[model samples]
Target: MSDPHKKIARKAELSKISSSFRRLSSRATLGAMVAGAAVLMFIAIGVGEHLATLALRENERLIGNDLAASVDKVLDGASTSSRANVKTLPGSPCIEVERKLAELETHLRYVRTVALVENGRVYCSSALGPIDVPLSAYVQARRRAKDITLLAETPFQPGVPVLAVFSSTTSNSGVLYIIEGEYLSDVLVHGVRYGAERAAFAISGNGVLDEKGRFHTAIDADAPYSTGVTSRAWPFTILVASSPSLMTRQRWAFAVASGAIGLLVAGLIAAMYLLAFAPRRLLLAAVRQGLKRKEFHVVYQPIVAVSDRSVVGVEALLRWHHAKWGPISPAIFMEEVESSDMLEEVTRFVLQTALAEMSALTPAFPLRIAVNIAPRDLQRKGFVAEVVAAVRSLPPNTTLVLELTERFLLSESALTSAAFSALRAEGVRFAIDDFGTQYNNLDLLGRFPFDYLKIDRKFVSQVDTVGADLIAGIVALARPFGVKVIAEGVETQSQHDGLESVGVPYAQGYLYQRPATAQSLATSISSSAASAQH
Candidate 1:
């Protein structure tokens, strides 16, 4: 060494340079963190605004439904009264009928007038004055009512508010028409204004503005007609117009609050990054700790045969227990894993655990285990080989059923087809889960091999009067394919009977048994067997 003092000075200089570099790096990191925080804040604000708008739209839709139902009830009552006495009353009883009609008019004072049509003429009225106008004139004037045979609201005149309710009665002789005009301006001015605190408007089927009328700018240029609840019903639309300025004000307030919060978060992140790398290090440490713990588990749901009510299969469903979140549904956590590369690890773990469980059960029943395969996993390189290896390692008696859902099947059809074929070669079964959901390509069904098709729970459960014909059609289609049909969500005895009668061979639903642990399943089977023996 040239000199001991020189060596010390050199070391000191090196330490000082290192300290300066660290300070510069920390400042750069702080800037990046601040930028990232600003981006995240912007994203959150966008999502919040979108969700709020969606909520508002849904609220409007629900309110409209409620209003429609209430109006329908009123129309029903009026129609009942009109049909009950219109034909039976003689000319002498006209006075009595007029008195009754006057009382009915009082009952419906909110209504402008109620007109009854018989023999293609306006025969009776609610008003006490003599009916001087010709029936033909009234009929021609009320041609709009003829177009809307069902109960509906239409604007009678420009600016003047009116609601038209039309109903028809069919007897052995011919059809009789009843029409009632109700003033909706009072209802709109009082009811809707009080509730929503906004200007309200309604429109008729002919695109005529109601209440405020043709002069009002409530109706937008692009407003479309509502097909109503029934398809055969006339085209009618409801428009509720409010001040656009109020909406703008609310949006501006939300934006300002969001921006302020975003700026504050950015400042906090900047400060933290400038001070230390504590937050990043903490996150990495937490992730590493989680991987080491190996706390993920799975729950099983039994799939029973409908005809015999025997446990034929169990679907292995993933479950996660976060130290903070307790038990989390797979639908959520699986999505997070799927977005990352850790999904393969999760699949391997599930496969191993499920196989081990199957091996452990003494005198293993001839049961199939259905596992949902994510499309991403199928697309992974060497995925098929890995799955084959896993299957080969499993016990001979265990039958693995791969359930490909419509979402996964729709994308990468060719890849999924190849995967299915390869798995089938290894003695594994394949099923199209939630079948009859969407219009699937029949050509694909013919070309690709599928062992079973699980009918969607919605279609299966609705095998009553409304859906009876549809269910019959589906059953008929499946019959030729020779593929066993398994109906899901058979909740009631009536539903079970309906499916069984319609040739649904198998089913999985709560009516038979809910999902249970391995031990609980065994106990359930034992109880069921005991009951059978008795």
Candidate 2:
């Protein structure tokens, strides 16, 4: 009986060991399968993205080359016709030239209107209807140069789009043109259909939409593209867009298959390593702890006066010093904050900190604090009231400079205007930050009772060196309207002198002083003011 009991115990032990080995083998196999799936999915995504990018880039190159070649052909044809009209014509050549031009127009129906420019004046024109031409510096420049200037989709007439191509015929003589009126619609329809597989469009420098017939995606031609020419000219942008539905379906299918395989593989690998490595409970714990411990801090950059180099204002810049990530840039963190819907909290913290710092400063100093207001903040319910309350909390002498960027300000005209008025009522000075960088309505400046016009850094950077006429015109426009011009990015003494020479009373840049903490700013200002007095 004792021998039989011992035999049963031995059998049970062997069975237990066998079961454990089987479990281990199954986990290992599962892990391998998951890893293989993950690798395959990764490869597919990489290949798809590469293919899409290559196709789009190649299409853009091809289209640009074709358009340029076509333009050259058109110019050559026009030039030949002009010479022929001069050689053989009865009576007034102008009348005969007009008749020849009419015949040419009928042949090239796509060419909207042809204008014969001679002696810096448009002598003759033909179109579907009469169009009024606005006198502009660009037109004057073209006339003076006697060189062919192609302006794609310029709105010479209100509610009408036309392509203007100016070409020189001989020395100091030329023909100015307008083309693709009704044909523009046809071209857009055709182009968009052809390029439907990829996102693409073309634009001119004067806020003209030349995207064939699809006016929906047509941005202001004057608006900045991510790349290409910085100066005003019609630059054609071709975009190749992927089908969203197809992408979504592919992603979903891949994710499901890959995720299941990855989980199985990871589980098997984790189990095998469990004996050597403790479960990664600490990593998850650390992440949870980090989320709770996250905090934000503020830094200040001074916006000083160009003339006396006096510290007039400070822009409050936000910084996040994450424990794990160290320091995250405002651009990256702000994106996260916005996506998380915690922007109001961030904005409150920044405003409160800046106002508190400024309030602690000496009353006699009278420094303005410029706070960046995001577009989302402007649209928030009770946002205007919150701003009013925040301003009230600050010292009476502390002036709040609401710096509204062009992109943010003009998005919702009625909402922005109301917000602007509300803030202005609280003695908050409004400044259009990055002025002249976009196709902004100058009339909007007149409409909005803004106290200061902060000329964009781009314009300021060039004012002293190259763009004198433009700078002069901007200063002239601002002066009479009681709007004080504050030139930003005044890096050189020459820039400062040029701005001061033109009566631009205020400025700010690295030349004056870098941004500092409130404590450092006080010391800097005292020293600056003393130097000015001396």
Candidate 3:
């Protein structure tokens, strides 16, 4: 093979290898982002499940505690009623016992009836008049106990489920208060948002009473996550049965949170990747060092009075002279930082430097120093506060104007609008930068409170009769709305005369003077002021 052919074939092989490396690099970055998102989602689900379990257990214990307290209350009421009417106990006048029992039944909503039991027989009752039914072994045991006891049974009226609380008196007798068993059901199964279904049961002796006081389980015996709590004062225990729906809902919540977190994490990882590769990495590093070492600087271009051609104010422009990149344009670095979330810092730097420089200038007139603001910075909650702080040290007579490009102005949200309103209240003015370039100029003029409309260079470059008419129309349209018009890129005598004839108040371009450093601009202002004094 010839030597040239061999060299050409080797070059083709190197190109393929480079392309393969690029593809691998991109895939590796994408895979890392996907893995980070997956890990975040799994962590969210695990944390949520653990929390849901805790909440379910806590809720069950609370319900059980409430049921126990309710039983204690009923028992106390019955005991009080029985002791107050001991004179009518098993003999003598039973009228006092009947009257007390009737009063208790009327006052307690859950209470079915109140009765006085002695020697295994009901002597007097609130609803059931004198009964001789045999007391079961469960009731007898409760009658002998010193504390309150709960039992479930069929009511004396037959076929109705009832839960009875027994409190033994000092006279070897006991007081009984019967309540509807569904009271326990209502406490167990009502008003919980997470749990799908719930059931409650009362354990009396060795048997479990269902929601309706039947001798059976309130839920299936093999129900998942069965929890129970024993009463402090009574022999009864309350058991709560819960389904899986509570956990399901919690998982759903976690899923939603995880999705949002995953997206945020993925976006952050992608941004990191972008910052780590090639020229961007070097650029970001340079920016960080530049900011740290105070390498970023600003220049001022004089905005002139069109009729007199005198310098009225200056527009601040950002510049960065890197040791490596050397004299980097703000259009490049600013866009880089904006995409990388460092725009706020850069904006703050520009604002602080511009305000300080303008303050030091102390021009003869109240110069309106205009600072460009990005849309993202304007939307931030603290943007207005930052601007206010930056301008606080300036000369009271000097005016601060915020200049926004048409794209940024159109992207204003409610928060940005509110910020603008606040800044306006503090006497800060706003201007629409590069106005005749976008189609929605009129809409923007109406929506935002703009003090100045600067025509773009393209429109002023026409330099003909039609250009004069367009500039005049804009100035005329803006007059009634209290907005002053300025022309940009006026390089020739014809453009200057055209703008002045149309009554345009201000102009900024190379025709007057190109943008200069702060020291040079200050010199020109001083030179002009000294000349005026002569």
Candidate 4:
């Protein structure tokens, strides 16, 4: 009997070892599969980006070549027309020469003026009645020496720059044509679909001409993906500069294709995780559906003055009620909302609902409604306008305040600053929410003109100890800027008293009242006001 018992124990031990070995083997296989997939994804992205870059470069080169050929054809026509009719131009009557030149000018669109230079002066002209200025100052000696040669020069016609084409006919006289350099800009840019930021221009003999006919001494050397081609007929070079959007379109196309392929490959390698991840996909789908159905709501937490313990305003918070998941916390869903394009929808809903509901439940004191804004929201072009429209329905004597955290304000952009200034002009106020958590708080404080700074709960929770001294320092620091200091998370009477001793004028926490529905808050405020009258 003892021998049989020992044999049974040995078999059990062997079975345990086999299970451990299988587990280790499974983990190793999964690691190898993940590493292999990452490498393939990296290679695919690199190849796609490389191909896109090549395509953009090729397109730029083609543009240069086409522009150069078009200019050459126009110049050739001007040179040929003058050479064929130079004999009749010289020694002819000024009226007869002007009539013939005018006829030539009518046939060509770019020829602004045509004249015949006799000796050192212009003898006759198609546009100008008669020329008295010396022609030698504008044209080179070679134009007079050669039998037939075309030369371009910079001669100011009025205030605009004109390209003077000197075509030599004989030693005594030559055919002179003045072309508006600005017209070249229209010719080059016609029917082209370059992006808004793109700059297409031409450079000739130390002078640059933009698409709008504006002239400069130099081109923008810092333009990305820039390239140029020299004209085959003349010394002019056409330069093209464009943004990375030209290639990003291709990169996106390849990325989407690779992503679909990667998903299929992953399903084959690890079917278990794919099946497990299905629930997450379902949850995301439900959240999307909830947004469409208007299953989200807003709640307000009363921000009471530490000095009076009465509600001065309320902070707006979003609440989501998933049909299957019951009540979902804002902390869990807000990150997801911010990551997707749904952030603007959520912000508009909260801002509209908070202002409308709170405006109707106006208390005795001026009700100030504070709304939290994410950094990405301010990056949009119409954010300032949107905020202005949202607060148009506010009740009389009420103020709308925007609360921004220090992290977002530290790297405050020019657009963000402009938005703040514009909103401030419209009577909207701003506050730095959850201050003192980041190292750049002082930098942001110095840069932006803030009306209030709310201390983070982490600092306010330790009010009896070092937190009290820290709060005092913050209040003193903000004293000069005329910024009010408010402490958050005043859960107990001791914490509130300590903060008040440190001169904190305002706070928001459960000790005064927790976040409640708008209707409940309206009733609570009315009851408190009646009690105070008694």
Candidate 5:
């Protein structure tokens, strides 16, 4: 070819080839991006479904626990009635026994009738007044051994479901209390909160009571869960479950939103990952590491009796010192740790270390050692056993008080109630910390068994001001509930004097002594013992 003409043609051909290569590369890049987006969405859908299932299961479990607690609370009344000691004998005139029975029934809530049994026969009744029915007719032969007998119908009240609670003063003499089924059914109806349509309360093959209060002769195979919650105080179990279709709907709803996010989020995953996990992860990991390195310790602030100004108890407070970050205020890292699983470990560390420190002192006087616990710690596996073991480890003269801090409202579940009952039985006491500041203050006192109510420091700080009326009101409110009031944050003599004037029995704060180390607390204890001896 000629040199100039050939060069022009070759340049044009080169340009055409370059343009084709650019078009192919654009198509391939677009295909890769589309594939990545699809993969991201698929992962998002799977993760969303998994999370939804977990959330639903947790909700079901919580509701089930609550329902069990409610049933226990109801039955607890009848159980108390059965144990009543009345001077009116079973063979006494129907009117006198009926009057006594009616009086006793009024004292026991949810109780319909209080009948007296003599020689295995019902001689005096509260509802029918004189009755001559055999106790065997009401209590089944097999169920007679237990405290409760479930009756689908009674001879006097036909077609009514009732629980027969028996307490024996002697082998032949006892009290029989009737609790209507409708009251228990009310608890069941409100128990299913998270999209669960069917809920039932059953007592070990005796019968099932549905949300409608209809008593079934037998438990349905389908309604009861493989893991139903059983009440510790009573022989009842709760069933709670969301429908399969509802679960599928939940998964799909979560999946669709997650898939849409996945399409837009693929480009920003790195930033989002950091935002989701950085601060919590970094701080939580440090806390875990700090625990292992013994960077955490507890200090005790003396809780004193307001009248006598004596060191009655001390509350254990946790402190941490990070190697890299220096001293970290619990206010900063604890919030991060508390929401994470690592909170369990931090709580255990503080509880165990605090007890160990107190054991070393073993002062002559009986000192109440108080430790704060998170709400989650109460329901965790081995929690009650852990506390019982710690309680046993303490000296007989020393008392251990678990102060439940009100960072979150503590849910009253059967498991929690069981924990409280077991520990309280073991002589371990409980106190509701930060009392006035939380939501549902009255509900907490009424629901849980607390030995003392610790007034939130803010109220104590205002003892010299407007909060005195509130303080007096709190003390008065606690009086009916029988929970002794202890004020926290007594910073001045005037505040202390105001707290005393308002009927606050006990208090703790900087006014008496700031939080001290174990060594200091031990020395103070020895001094207090010496003073008491003198």
Candidate 6:
């Protein structure tokens, strides 16, 4: 007999462990989700900042292009006026050339002084009545210089920086015009209003004129992203110093929104894991693996007639020789499985194996092979078809009897009745197992068509004292329905004798035979055949 106390204690321990595991699993899941979400959020923010900086860098390049266009416009106007207007000065007298130079100076934009240079000599000026200065005094010497020049100071105004533009009319003669430095600085400095922090204009080799009207020989190279746009119309470049502060603001805003999205996705994944895949996964997976590994098999216990003890049939009982646990009692696991969906897999394993094993036998007499089934399997559509397939595999000498173990009621509806009728036509039979124990057996017998009633083991164990009168009454009640009675668990000779005294016809228990493997049964058959031959 199985140890009932150990089974109860094992079940209680498993329940307690399952509860603890569930709590631990839930907390671990939450922590993992939070860490995963945080990682995703940080990655998203980093990527968002990178993309935003690229866009901002492109924007700054466009702003520099726009500023370059403005500088082109101003230089284009200055170039046209310096050549066409200054050449029209009177050439007759010095005083007249000086008056014409002053008038041209007053009309030209950004011009400080206009002078005439002939054969590398500056002879006249606009600000002074007469002047004598070499052409090289204001700029580097060139025979036909048509370029810009930077002057830090003049003889008259001591320390005022100016630009000299020479537009040549001949190889050695050209008009010399001086331009104000402040106006050039103003055009370059306007970039501050757009995005740059510091703005300046750099001449080819002279100096850099900054936004503050000051000049330096070299510009700062360490400034972040110092952008330069060279003028196509002049011999200088516009430079602006930049920082990432412009894109920083927009990057942070986009990062916050992306972080929120990451959290929502993590929450959805965690919810799906808990709801759809976590609970009961371990037990179900183990059962599925157990089936694949062929850990389960069937055994048979012979049933004998009460009068002469002749072996008439056998009841097929499922036995599990687990690889890890080694011979688990069905009582410990069956209750849990009956309450779950794995009951069908277990039932089909026993049913198919028992039928095939019984069909392989060539016994001298007809044999009844009974297999137990749970009530829930009858409600399935494919169940009847599976049974029909297994039943057809048997030979004519063997009969298959299904004993219904009613953990739940097998409904007596039209659909179920049709299923039973279809199988009954194929010579399949039914027995109500453990009758008069968990439910009202008399009501059950009237509701469904049954061929046999198996008396529960509790009644058989106590037959001499309490169950003797009860078995007599149950056998009397079963007589009108044409139902036969089988008393189970007949352990002693006196119990068997008592069953006979009560007129029970068929029985199965340890007093007659214990459950044995298919190989054992075959060995017994071979020995009996050898004895008969002698």
* Ten-residue stretch with the least lDDT total in model 4: 143-152
lDDT of 3: 0.70
Reference-based TM-score of each model: 0.44, 0.43, 0.47, 0.46, 0.47, 0.46
lDDT of each: 0.57, 0.60, 0.70, 0.71, 0.78, 0.74
Alpha carbon RMSD to native, model 4: 24.0
List the lowest-lDDT window of 10 residues for candidate 3: 525-534
Q: Name the best candidate (by lDDT).
A: 5
For 73-95, candidate 3 gives per-residue lDDT tens digits of 65555555445554345442357
Candidate 3 Cα errors over 4 Å, as ranges:
1-20, 23-282, 362-365, 464-466, 527-534
Flag regions of model 2 displaced more than 4 Å.
Answer: 1-295, 335-340, 362-364, 411-414, 527-534
Count of residue pairs whose backbone atoms collide, per candidate: 0, 9, 0, 0, 0, 0
Global fold similarity of model 3 (TM-score): 0.47
The TM-score of predicted model 5 comes to 0.47
Give me the runs in candidate 5 sitting further than 4 Å from their true place. 1-277, 362-365, 530-534
Stretch of 10 with least lDDT, candidate 6: 525-534
lDDT of 2 by residue, 280-322 (tens): 4443343235345755666777766666777777788776565
Candidate 6 local lDDT, 430-524, one digit each (tens) = 88888877755597778877888999989999887777999999999999988899999999988998999999988889987789986577654
- Where model 6 places Cα greater than 4 Å from the true spot, the runs are 1-279, 363-365, 523-534
Candidate 5 lDDT over residue span 255-335, tens digit each: 888887886587465334433545667767777888889899899898887887777788999988766545556877776
The digit string of per-residue lDDT tens for model 1 on 381-483 reads 7888977887787655567877767545654477867887888999888777888776564444565577777888898778854665776677677667766
Give the candidates in order of lDDT, highest first: 5, 6, 4, 3, 2, 1
Give the runs in model 1 whose Cα sits over 4 Å from its true position: 1-292, 410-415, 438-443, 525-534
* lDDT tens per residue, model 4, 246-353: 557756876666666666565444544433444555545656788788888888898877776767778888888766445666765666666667778778888888
